[model samples]
Target: MFAGHDPYLVALSVIVAILGGYTGFGLAARIRGTPGLARRLLLAGAAGFLAVGIWTMHFVGMLAAPIPPAAAYLVLPTIISFLICALVVGISLFFVSIGDPSRQRVIASALLLGAGIVSMHYVGVHAVSGPFHIVHRPGMILLSSLIAVLSAYGGLRIYLARQGGLRLVLSAVAFGIAVSGMHYTAMHGMTFSTMPLDMVPMSDGLVASAQVLSLVVALLCFVIAAGFLLFLVPEPRPRPLAGFPGGFYPASEAPGPVSEGLQTASRSDRSVMTTAPLGGIGQPRQLPVQRIPVEAADGTRLVDVTEIRAIRADAHYTMVHDGQRERMCSWSISEAETKLDPAVFIRVHRSHIVSLPHVAFLRKEGDGAIVELDGPQPTIVPVSRAKIAEIRARLGLTKTVPPRH
Candidate 1:
């Protein structure tokens, strides 16, 4: 007849499972900010869960009563254990990905719980060490499932708390402590080999306590490790200066071909002859400062500066200034100057090459016109008027605009 199981190894596996689970969850949460990246992490975490579960089961099983040698059967049970654990973890991750739990963070915890059960059952089997059978009793299975669920729920809750604005460090510490307790409780229920009632060594309690303590420490370490993994994934920060080359410059700052070629010229040619006329065709002359002339949409007077007090680019004919008024006007800028300063910004509409700073909102209009300058500005800048559908796509907006007539 097959003997009973060992309690010490059961507890140890529980602790390990929790740690592995939490680590996976934290990883998924950190990268969730990216759209598809979190799903990949979840799937990968499921595989990891299976591996850890198998390893823990093997080791824990050996720790039980010494198993009689049956090498062939050993590998089979291990495979079976790993598959069961993997299925649980994979299913859990599927729910997590679908539910959108903080970048599929729930995957980790689920894996931990599932693997813990696999490890415990196999470890118990190892203690028996015989061609034994485990009659799958409903009560034992139910109890094991409950333990896994509790551990998984705890792990997931800790991660969610971080996303919900809880202090991450504190939450991790709390989670680790909780995992330790849950795993220890799970270990208490194992029914192992019954040698003689009084024959068990006194040192068994010391060994058992040490194992449980080790499990707790492992869990604590896992929590810290998971926390660090979450931090490892990088998030996009605001570019210091919104424009390129790390500084803000107008669209006219782009260099001209002549100037570019001159810079590329080698050596002594760098110095220009002062004898060259102050301004000439072959000489480097101070090109006229092409003023980006600003105008009022109401067709006001042409002036050096915008009278609307805050006029900013809104494509070719559109602009916004003084918080709400929209101006649409025809304007010109020297092509040479624009080529030099490509950073000037992109034109959003025929009337709207809005300065990045001035644009407050972007919305789609019903008539194939993407409505820019969304605030109180009375003028609904028509984007469809220009071939600006590409801009809409870049902004991740649907083509809500009607087809141009």
Candidate 2:
């Protein structure tokens, strides 16, 4: 016969699952902004959190079920199950984050993740050692597997979309449902049969008591709570005085004489400035930026202004497309515009800027226009209604019309 589950414990398990999902997904979202070792570490941490969440939820659900009094958990199998979850989760994340994740890659990753969840669930279930045998209905196992796959795909899509606020919360909730639903559904189809009195349980293998398991679960819960809190802490904004015209400098290294001009320059003029020695007396001259700072896997590198085809805004930072591939830039869109020569580069849209010299094609699209920049991998930048006329004039496309007939 099926075992009854504690409703309160079930609810608690769901909560733990949701919290873990939220924290793990939040960490993964930051992987895009980070580079190299930092990105790998973050990915690992995210996987660990997610694995812990799934493992914890499964055990909590198991605790809720009324198993035979003689049943105990095998330490080795329980530990192996958790390791399996972590390994698969890490592999899945790595697959998606490595390069441009295609549709096939995403699907493959999702399949792997879903299979990992199912494997962890069953492995954990089989860890129970006692004078009883467990059997699961084939149909229910298939249904649970389907739910796992679908839920995993949905979660990955949401993460890729990168929408924050309400969407992230909803995704976490859905993930919680997916994990808990699969566990309970499988449990529903499970039947336990008592073993014969002569049957002997293994005595050599180490086992964990319910009390010890409770302590472990409590410790994991605390770790998840701590991670959740740390994730909520907002990143400190860089101080205004910590930047220079051509690049960023420490506040302590900032020149004193130019500080006034730096503070007084308008957004557009901030990047166009000249400075003299600390005590020298001379009129300031123009010193436009020649190179743009961008981040790469190896390290921070500078891209020549002439090499930039387009710059797209990414929150507080910008993405620099250097005719080949896009690289993350530490500068804001406003900063990029101010620093680059206005004669060649133009801010065509709120979030986009294009190099006029690289303009290969321009076409009117509805109320605005689109300009294709010539490069190995051509980029299309949108032209806002306000900037359409200016973009046309800069590209020598503006034409005079004859008098009306």
Give all candidate RMSDs, comma-separated: 19.1, 7.6
lDDT value, residue 60 of candidate 1 = 47
lDDT by residue (166-197, candidate 2, tens digit) is 66787788988888998898898898899896
RMSD of 1: 19.1
Worst 10 residues of 1 by lDDT: 267-276
Estimate every model's Cα lDDT from 0 to 1: 0.41, 0.78
TM-score between candidate 1 and the true structure:
0.38
TM-score of each: 0.38, 0.69
Candidate 1 per-residue C-alpha lDDT over 188-287 given as tens digits, one digit per residue, 9 for 90 to 100: 4443343543554332111223245336345544544464466456554222333223342222222344333332333223222211233443765343
